[model samples]
Target: MDALDASVPAISPSRPFRASVVTFRALVGSGFRRYATYRQATVAGTFTNIVFGFLRCYVLLAVAAGTAGAMAGGYDARQLATFVWVGQGLLNVVGIWGWADLSERIRTGDIVADLVRPVSPVTAYLAADLGRGAHALLTRVAPPVLVGALFFPMATPSRWQTVPLFAASVLLAVVGSFGCRYLVNATAYWLADARGPLAFWTLGSGVLAGLYFPLRLLPDWLAVTLWVATPLPGLLQTPLDVLIERDPPALQAGLVALQAVWAVIMLALAGWVQRRAERKLVVQGG
Candidate 1:
């Protein structure tokens, strides 16, 4: 062998910097393109969301109208309508369900290939999810809002700060949702079949994350408890609340801060869990 070949060192798959930012960006772009290829599914899902948005908006409107001029769950009719429609948009943006990629790979033992790749699984998956979120933001978020605006009175943010704040909250929601799904898929490391956990996650995330209804509609204590204890509200409630200016300036900023904190925490936890899982798999000759 030549001196150049002799001097070159082998690269390990898990080298800390194996996956660079460019690689992540490419992964995200590819992920976006992958979903874009599913044109029919996107069209169908968007239609379903709009249909559900109408049903949910009507229900919330009825609840608000029945309040006899009192703010039901701190929302008037217009705000409630905004909540329903924005939530329909966010439902796809946050991607509360239909994420079985990692678990499916694990079930088929293809996770071994992923584990050996020169990339962090958590980050690679996260980049792809962000891509998916971007696609959803384009294809799914706007149609419902536009359609609802035509049919119903929609609430607008009071302060200009709320616009940027809502955007940040939405981005963090995507991150936090990815973390939650990552941890859920990571369970495949332990369980032979991850479908059960994925099912459980799908069922609970919608209600707990306030996709079904505004968290404020629940009793004060329950709402506060969930907010303090779980990242669920940060996934959907925070962004919607910010968009409608449900809280004062200080509280709105605080809510976004909390979402950021949770996103970091959950992502860190996912990375740690994945590392441990990889080590365990290696020891078992996986």
Candidate 2:
């Protein structure tokens, strides 16, 4: 037989899409299993949460004592307590460490393999993040919430209406935070050294995002400017506000709008960087 007749035909199917689904499923399953195995880490996280919550509560109580019962930034003792509780609890679920290893993947050429996957790179990355978030919420987030409930009675949402609103706000916060991190991580494609950039961005964003403290305590103009220019408020501050404060509809709507705007901008930037990186890979064999 001729060579062509003797040889079996290659069986190649669409792999990128299938590969992406496999990657997502593997990440989710691994995250669930890893979470089960990390009991010590989970306990340590709980202890840390308790310690920080105690310290924050103490500081707030001391400040309140000096303020002579006057409310600060629309939060009284009870509301402030609730704020700390919610903030600390949500931190775990928020996955605020930023895009896990996206920068490293890009810099080390692993992104080349990722780019060949049939799924959208963005979607795949987000699936991994969601897995982490799920793990944290089940372990870390629960401890803070339980501790808060035992130690302090928070203001429960008065109406059922608030539940959906809070849920929506939290969803937007997650998306906004993910987009911001993705944007920052994508800079690795262009920058020779991205650690410094990542550090600077993380610190600035952390401060503005209310990961450490509430932005309501900042000067009005400064808070407004940061909220408008950055994705920080949408990620932490806005969600916290919705969870604790009874913000007017105008403010709530404004925050949501800002989140949408930032999501669009960051997504556009990430897409542009990713396309450029893909071209570079084609030329340089990354």
Best by TM-score: 1
Could you tally the backbone clashes for each prediction? 0, 3
Task: Give lDDT for model 2.
Answer: 0.71
lDDT of 1 by residue, 201-258 (tens): 9989989998888999999899988888899999999999999999899999998999
Between which residue pairs do clashes occur in model 1?
A: none
Q: What would the per-residue lDDT of candidate 2 be over residues 1-286, giving only the tens digit for each residue?
A: 4685332333336766665466677666555665668789778877888889878876875666567555666667777777777778777677666444888886676776777787667776666666766777677766776787788757766656456667777766766777777777877777734687788877887788886767877888998998897778877778778766557766776777787787677667767767777676532233
Q: Residue 161 in candidate 1 has what lDDT?
A: 91
The TM-score measured for candidate 1 stands at 0.91
Over 4 Å off, model 2 = 1-37, 282-286
| TM-score list, all predictions | 0.91, 0.81
Weakest ten-residue segment in model 1 by summed lDDT: 4-13
